[model samples]
Target: MKHALVFVASPDDKPAYREALLMLGRVALSRKLPPPDVLSGWESAQWIYDSVDGELRQEAAAAVAELPVDWALTPVAGRKKKLLVADMDSTIINVECLDELADFAGIKAEIAAITERAMRGDLEFEPALRERVAKLKGLATEALQKTYDERVRLNPGAATLVKTMAANGARCVLVSGGFTFFTERVAEAAGFHASRANTLLEDATALTGLVQEPILGRAAKLDALRSEARALGVSEQDALAIGDGANDLDMIKAAGFGIAYHAKPLVAAEADAKIDHMSLEAALFFQGYRRGEFVS
Candidate 1:
């Protein structure tokens, strides 16, 4: 089947330069394919080669890797997904919300170590999250608002990816193991259709050190993908899931295009796709959308 080799580079890298495109074209030729369809933009490019087998695609992808760019080769069919599911901490935004919350409680190092272990798949997500949140006991409720205001920043291309996909009639959902407080704000900022996350319990003045029961962990993330796909009247194959932690594994595996976005080592190794060197907008390119076609 026909597949696309999508290459993206940061502005400083300029891997979409003329010579790089020429080299990519040559690489396609070496794979016994005609010159590729070059979907070049300011910072990325997509080389659509005709009917290349998976083995050939891998070889072509390896050749392109020598350049300062990231690439993904996927079947042409269903390249344009109708649903977008994403994780919050460390994936959509820069910092782990829990770790930031931990800082407010003066236990950032301890909580962060647990976070690292869980994200790396060395610890169970639900128990790990509960343990971490427990450490934040008695933290002022006001600190939640302050943390969101001062610490949270969207990852590059987050808005572009969500706005572009949602603008194109795709159902964009932010499903995070993080708290609903952050997901609500993030969904609004990034233009997602809806958001779902764990609810952090709090009293009048401070956190109760408890999250609502049945913590939304790895399994729940997958369930969100399935549920969202059902609500959107689409199958799982028409969806794209992106995240950076072990909790994102099931959802990533369930979606048609599961991307590990600057992920932990375990996730990066297992996801169907990965984006280590580019922004979330590269997900659009992975679906064969040209740069000009992006809605935002």
Candidate 2:
């Protein structure tokens, strides 16, 4: 079967050496991919290889860690998906927004512990989220805006991934278990076509310690994926989903190409593809796109 191996270096820590690509070319049944068609170079590359068999591709991908880069292995056909459904916290953004909110409430360690457990699948998502939010009850409403301004920054290559995908006519949606307040900002900044998230209820000037009912958890994420795919006149297999925590598992598993991006251990173990050492643009390479083709 025809396969492709995408190699990605850490965006900020890219090695200064040159032999990494040379060594990669020595693998049997593989040919070097040309330099990025739209740019002078790229931090990641793809090799459209004629694998001797199915397992050979897996074996090659597994062994790529020995090199100075991270990698993903996927089939050559339908590599570029038509839709992108992604998680916001710890996936599109560098910090978990709720945890940052916890910091403003002076309960950082306590709330972050629950967040860690919830993300690792050690705790039920709904209950954990409630517990965390409850602790922030009575906190000033402006804290949300403050957290967004001071702490919420996009993860490396996040914009490049969303914009490039959108430019290729793919629809991008930010479906997060976080909140609408942050998702609205992130989706706009990242250039996603739509956004959906739970709403954090607020009183006159403070949080009400409650989220609107029917909280958007794991199941909701899956629903959003299906609904978006249907609206786009595509099957679930035509979509790509990426996330970094337990709440994202269902949709991640349901998509044609699901990736765990710098994910928790449980997610990484179950996702179709895992990106542990690269930026969001690695997802683009996984879809057979070159850096030059990126919109921004």
Candidate 3:
């Protein structure tokens, strides 16, 4: 039997698994008697249905194509992901770093505008990152931790996703364009195996207003994937990546399964799977996991 993964994207609507299975069956039967083996997974509000059928693989592949913002079709074994690397801002959590920092700087509206351009692929993320960080100059560095306490919020199902992945023997790595200070705490709370992000420099109990050079951008986010893959004894094909900005392209392209979660148009167009309509748990489908079987 050959495998097929069907993902539905519509962040605003969640479909019932029973109903989705029924509809999928109708779609498959409409092609003739190519009955198949199926595995299922879900997140946010959508369900992913995987079917194995040698006779109808081609037709099934065509049927599910372009039905959503992002979907992945692969041989069942080919789609299984052994590692998951996720972005923190607007991903594992709902807030963007620079936008929140702007709030602290009393220029929330202005910085948020810059952030919008950057996330939408309109502005370069590295330069925008620098400009935003520069604005934070002179703010007490302790504010970083305060931001962690007041603004760093986890998205729905984020904890479930990480804990579930880890329990299943998959390594969960939290990579971010934000900062290591927050990434560290997020890793602990989410039960992540490890994490990487830009370091915010501080001295004398105040903001240094500087990020250590060689910041982690999209390129660096990609490097975290490679680094984690090696640590986990896997190849690029053994990895999965999820993020919501232009900077995530590198890791997404290199991974076995790249997911765009509530992403901008640019990211959704290119990733292996997209899950804007649901929670982070939706990623389990690429790993061949079913909702009932989810560890958490």
- Candidate with best TM-score: 1
Q: Show pairs that collide, candidate 2.
A: 38-292
Clashing pairs in 3: 11-277, 44-278, 44-279, 141-207
Candidate 3 residue-wise lDDT at 86: 92
Worst 10 residues of 2 by lDDT: 31-40
TM-score of each: 0.95, 0.91, 0.83
Better of 1 and 3 by lDDT: 1
TM-score computed on alpha carbons, candidate 3: 0.83
What's the true lDDT of residue 108 in model 2? 97
Q: Order the candidate numbers by TM-score, best to worst.
A: 1, 2, 3
Model 1, residue 211: distance off in Å is 0.7
- TM-score, candidate 2, is 0.91
lDDT of 2 by residue, 202-269 (tens): 99999999999889999999999999999999999999999999999999999999999989989988
Better of 2 and 3 by TM-score: 2
* Candidate 1 lDDT tens digits, 1-296: 66787677666755355555666767776767655555655566665666765476567566666666667878888888999999999889999998998888888999999999999899999999889888888999998999999999999999999998888889999999999999999999999999999999999999999999989999999999999899888999999999998999999989999999999888888787789878888888888877888776
Q: Which stretches in model 1 have alpha-carbon errors above 4 Å?
A: 15-23
